[model samples]
Target: MKKINQLYTGFALAMMLLMSSCVKDLDQQPYVQETSASVYAKAENYKRVMAKVYASLAVGGQEKGDGNADLSGRAANAYLRIYFNLQELPTDEAVYTWGGGDALNPLQFITWNTTDEWSAAMYYRILYTVGLCNEFLRNATDEKISKFTPAEVAEIQAQRNDVRFIRAVAWSHALDLFGIPPFVTETDPVGAFFPRQIKRPDLFSYVESELKEVAAALPSRTQAEAGRASKGAAFALLAKLYLNAEVYTGTGKYSECVAAANEVIAQGYTLEDTYSKLFNADNDKRTNEIIFAIQQDGMNTTSWGGTTYLVCGPIVGSMNATERGVQSGWSSIRTTPQFVSLFTDVTGTTDRRARFHTDGQSLDINDVTLQTDGYGLTKFTNKTDAGGNGSNYAEGLVDTDFPMLRLADVYLMYAEAVLRGGTGGTATEALGYVNQIRTRAYAGSNAGNISQGDLNLNFILAERGRELFWECTRRTDLIRFGRFTGNTYLWQWKGGVKAGTTVNPRYNVFPIPAADRAANPNLEQNKDY
Candidate 1:
C-alpha cells in the first residue's frame, strides 16, 4: 500500500480545510472555507481529507513546490523540515552554513530568541495537522459510522484510530520540545478559537493514554499499509515517551520504557540487512523495518522540505549532484567534527555507516560559513539501490520516506532503559541487541561488536549518533543524557564560539512563541524566556 499515491492534492481539500488556530503564531484563522459536513457527505471524501492530514507531514500545501501552502512560508516550513531544524540544528549533529542572521541560522550557535520563525512554524505545523485530525475524529462517530456500510465503517474505525496515533505523536513532540503548548481536541469547536495550554505532565498522560489505546486497536504490523500507523508504531512511540519519561514527568519510568520496548519487539518488526538502504529513494520497500514513515513522492507530493531537504541540503561545491539524484546542490548543511570523530575512521574504510564526503572539505569547522569547513554527509540520497533516480528527481524533489519510528531506534531505547535499571529486560538481552545493530553497521562483521560490560549509557549515546544522527534524535538523546546544555558536552560553535562554550540551562526547552502568548493570555511563557 503505497499511500503516497493516495495523498489528496485536490483544490477541494484546500478549500474545505479548517486550519487549526493556536493564535497569531499559526495564522490559521483565515483558512476556513467549505463546511466539513458537506465535504464528508461523499463517502470517498473521508479518505481524501485523511490523506490531506498525512500530506501535511510531507508537503506544505495542496499544490506543488510551496505554492498555496497549508502553512505560510516556503517549502522549508513543512512539518518534517522545521522538525529537523528544531531537533538537529540546535545540536551537534548538523550545521547549516547559510546563516545570514536568519532565525534558522542561530540554532547552531544557540542564540535564538522567542520570536524565531522556525519554532513558530513547527508549532503551527503540529497544530494544523492536529486540527485536521480533530475534524476527522469528530465526524467519525457512531452516528456518522451508521451512514457507511459495515466494511467502510470498519475501515473508518481503523483510520480514526490512526488519526489518534498521529495526534498523540504531535502532543508527544510538544511534551518533548515545548514545556507547555496550547491544547485542543475533537470536542473543541471546528473554527477559530483560543485554546488552553496543557501542562507538560498532563500532555504526557494524554499522549500516553492515546498511544496505549491505538497500540491495541489499530492493525497489526503486517496488516497496516505502507505509511499508515501500525501497532508497532504506537509501541515504538510509547517506548520513546517512556524513555524520556524522567524529563517530561519528573519521574523515572525506565521500567515502563522497557515494557513498551518489549511490546514493540513482540510486534515482529525486524532490522534491515543493509543500513544505507533504509534511507534511500526505495526505502518504502523496507516496510519490514520502518514501523511508520511520512511518505514522500517526488512527482506527486513535491515539496522543498521533507526528504528533499535531506538529499540536497548537504550536497556541496565539489560533490556530484547527479550522483545524489538531484540536478543541483543547495550547499547548505554539513556534519560537525564531534560527530565525525564518533567513527574511528571518517573515511568509512571499515564501517559502511560512516558515509562522509571529505574530498575538498575539512573535518574541522573553523569558519562556519565555508562549505569546505565540515565533512559533507552522504547518508541521505534520492538515488535508488538499483542505480536510478527518484520519481521527482528532475525537479530536485525526492522520493525518500522519513522513518519516524524504526526497530533500530527501539533496540537502542530498550538497551538504554535496561542500563538505567529497568527490570523487564536484562543486560545480556541489551548487549545482544546493541551487537545486532553494531554488526549491521559493520556490515555483518563482528568488528564493531561490544561486550555486556561495554553496554553503558555513554556508549549507548555514541552508538546512537553512529546509527541515527541525521534521523533527528540527537538533541533529545543529549537532553536525556544531561548534555544538551551547560559545560558537559560541547561541539563546534555550541554557544556562538569557535572553541565551543556552555549555554544557559534555560535553552533546554524552546520558549513558547511570544506571539502565541500575546494572542492567548491563558498561555504562559517557559521560564526565563
Candidate 2:
C-alpha cells in the first residue's frame, strides 16, 4: 500500500476541513460539508480520507510544491523538514551556514527565544497533524459506524485503531520535544472553550496506553502495508517512549524499554547490507529495516521540505550538485567538527557510514557562519545503490524517503537499556548486538569488533553517533545521556559563544511558542522561557 498515491489524491476534497480557532489552541468547528457527508457515505472513501491523515506528514498540503496548504507557508511548513531542523540543528550533529542572521539560524547557535518563527512552525505542525487525527476519530464514532454495514464497521474499527497509533506518535513527539502540549481529542466538542494543557507525566501515560492497545490491533510486520502502521512501528515507538521515560515522567523505565525493543527485534526485520542504501532514492522498498518513514517521491509527492532538504541542504562549495542528484546545492546544512571526529578515520576507509565530502572543506569549524568551515555530509542522496542518479528523481527534487524509525536504532536502544540495568538483556547479549552493528560499519573487519570489557555507556554513545548521526536522534540521545544542556557537554558555538558555554537547563525543552500562549491563556509556558 503506497499510501501517498491514494492519499494525496484526496486533497481537493480536503477543502471540507474545519478551521481551528486561534484562541482555542486548535479549536474545531463541526465538520458540516455536504461533500464530506457524501464522501463518507462510501466505505472506500474512508480509506482515502485516512491517507490524508498520513499525507500531512509527507507533504505540506493537498497539492504538490506549496499551493493549497493545510498550514501557512507550505514551503517551509513540512513536518519532517521542520522536525529535522529542531532536532538536529541545535545539537552538534548539524549546523547551517546560509544567512547567519536569519531568524531560524538562532536555533543552530542555541540563541532562539520563544518568538522564533521556526520554533512556532514546529509547534503548529505537530498540533495540525494531531487535529487531523482528531477529526478522523470524530467521524468514526459509534453513531457513524452504526450507519455502515457490519463489514465496513469492522474495517473502520481497524483503521480507527491505526489512526490512534498515528495520534500517539504525534503526541509522543509533543511530550518529548515540548514539556507538555495542549491536549484535545474526539470527545472534545467543536467550538468548545480552549483546551487545557496536559503535563508530561499524564501525556506519557496516555501515549503509552494508546500504543499498547493499537499495537495489538495492527497487522503483523510481514502482513503490514508499505506506509501503514504495523505492530512493529507501534512497538518501536513504545520502546522509544520507555527509553526516555525518566526524562519525560521522572521515572526510569529501562526495563520496559528493553521489553518493547525485544518485541521489534523478534519481528524478523533484517537490516540492509549497505548502510547508505537505507537513505537513497529506493529506500521505500527497504521496508524490511525501516519500521516507519515519511514517504517522499520526486514526481508523485513533490515538496521543498522533507527529503528534498536532506538531499540539497548539505551540498555546498565545490561539492558536485549533479553527483548529489540535485540541481544545485543549498550550501546551508553541515555537521560540526566534533561530529566529524566521531568517525575517527578521517579517510573514511574504516567506516562506510562516514559519508562525508571533505573536498575543499575543513575539519575544524573556526567560524560556524562560514560554508567552508565544516565538512559537508553526503549521507543522503537521490542516487541508487548502483551509483546512478535515481531514475525516479527529478532535478531540484528527490525520491529519498525520510526514515523516522528503523531496526538499527532498536538494536542500540536495547543495548543502552540493558547497560542501564534494564531487564531482559545481559551484558554479554548487549555486547554481541553492538559488535554485530560494528561488523557492518567496518565491512567485517575483525579490528572493528569490541571485547566484552570495552562495552560501556560511553562506548554506546559514541557507537550511536557513528551509526545514527544526521538521523534526528542526536539531541534526544544527548539529553538522555545528560549532555544536551548545561556544563556537562559543550560543542562549537553552544550557547551562542565561540568557545562554547553552558545554557540554562530550560533549554532542554523548547518553550511553548509565545503566539500559542498569547492566543490561549489556558496554556502555561514552560518555565524560564
Candidate 3:
C-alpha cells in the first residue's frame, strides 16, 4: 500500500511533465482558472500534478540571495519560525526583540499578529499542492488517455495516497499553528471559497481519520520507491499525530502512539549509532536512521540547491577555517544558551559544551572557537569551498538530505509516550529508550537510570530539545507541553519576561494570513488577530 502511494506520487510527477507541455495557457493563468478536463487528459498528465505536489515540499526556508546579511533574514522567514519560537518567546529564556522588519520581530509585541500576506502565502501554497493531487486522482482512471498496466495502476493509486499523506502534514501544520482552518478537500470546486474556521478539535479529528485510512494501505519498504513515501513514514506521522492528540483534539492516544511506533519498529528500523553521523554529508542514503527525506542532488537536472544548509549555516564570524570562508548573509540562528548547556562530558571530566561554538575562522560553526557564545548552530555547517567566489556565502550546493522522519525520533517518542502512561508501561522502559539516543551521543547511559519523578513531562520536553534541536521539532514539542508561550530567553521579543512563566494562548496558534482574508472575505481572522 505504501508503494502504491509512492507510485501514485511518482505518476503525479509524470502528470506534471505532460501538463506542462500540453496546457498552452496554464503558465499564463491562475491555478483556479485552470480546468481539470483540459489538464488531466492522460496518465502522463496526472504525473505532472504529482510533480507539483512533490515540488511544494521543497519550498522551505533557505539562504537569502544577497551574500552578506543574516541567514534568518526574509529568505528564511516562514511558518517555521512560528513553530520554533512558539514556546521560547512567552517564557523568559528567549524573546522576539523588536527592531528587524522580519516577521519574527513582531512576535515580541503583545499585539503582534501574523501578517495576512504571510498567512495567505502558506495557505495558497498548501491548497495549490492539494489541488494538484486532487486533479491527478480525478483523471488518473480516464480511458481516453493511454491505459496503465495493472501494476502501474496500483502504483498510481498509492501515489495519490502519498499526496494525501503530504496533505495531512500541511493540514497538521496549519491546525497546530492556526487552531482552526478552512478544510478544503478535492470534492470542493476549484475556486470554491470556505468561510468558517473549523474548531481545533474538529480539525484534529479530520486529520486523524485521514491518516488512519491511508497509512495502513501504504506499501512496505523497497529500493525502487526509495526517497518516496513509505509505510514506515506513514506510521511515523501517525505516531506524531497520536503523540500530540491530547493537545490537538482533547484526547489522549498514548496507546495509539505505541501502536504506530511499534509498527515502524517491527519493520526492522533502528537508531543510528552516532548523533553527528545522522547529519554527516557523506552518509546520505546510507543512514538507516532516516525513514523519509526530501531527496536532493547538487548536479544539473537533479538539484534542490542545498536550501537547508544554506539557511542554517554560520555567518561571517563563525565559518570553518580550513574550508569555506565567511558567509556574510548568514543569519546567526544562535542556539539558546539554555539549549547549548544541555550537553555534558561523557567522561564526566572536561565540559564539551563548547563543541556547539564556532571560532572566528570561517562562516561554518564546526570551525569556530570553543569559547564563542553558543549562538551559532553547528548542525548544518557547510564544508565545501566549491563556490566560484572565494566566500563561503558563494558555495553553490551541499547534498544534505532534509530528514522528515528518522528512527531516533521513533525510539524517543515511544519512550516518552510510555513514560506518560500512554502505553500502560513503566518509566524504566522509557528511560532505556532515551538512553539509546544519549549513548549514541557519547553521553553515557546515565539517562537510562533516571527515576520516575525525573521522567516527568518537563524532563521529557528538555530531552527532546537536546536531541532534536534544529530538526524543526522543537516548536511542536514546546507547544504540546504548554511551554511554547511561556519560556523566556535573552534577545526575546517580549523583553524582561521571566523564563518558563508567562502565558499567551494566542501564541499557540497563528493568525490567518491577512491576504487570505482579503481574497476570501469569508475567511475569519483567528481571535485576537
Best by lDDT: 1
Q: Please report how far candidate 1 places residue 211 from its true position, in Å.
A: 0.2
Tens-digit per-residue lDDT, 63-163, candidate 3: 12212211232323323333334433333232222224445444433334656334444555455555656665556543534366666667677667777
Report, for all candidates in order, the number of backbone clashes.
0, 0, 68
> Each candidate's TM vs. the true structure?
0.95, 0.94, 0.77
> Runs in model 3 with CA error above 4 Å?
1-39, 60-101, 107-111, 114-120, 141-147, 300-306, 309-313, 321-329, 345-355, 358-374, 382-395, 424-426, 443-453, 487-503
lDDT of prediction 1: 0.84
* Order of quality (lDDT): 1, 2, 3
- Residue pairs in collision within model 2: none
lDDT of 3: 0.55
In candidate 1 the C-alpha lDDT for residue 260 amounts to 94
RMSD of 3: 6.8
Question: What is each predicted model's overall lDDT from 0 to 1?
Answer: 0.84, 0.82, 0.55
| Model 1: per-residue Cα lDDT over 318-407, one tens digit each | 999999888999899998899898999987768888999989998889988899899999998898999899987668889898998999
Better of 1 and 2 by lDDT: 1
Off by over 4 Å in 2: 1-4, 15-36, 73-76, 99-101, 391-395
Best by TM-score: 1
For model 1, the stretches where C-alpha displacement exceeds 4 angstroms are: 1-3, 8-33, 74-76
Q: Give residue 276's lDDT in candidate 1 (0 to 100).
A: 88
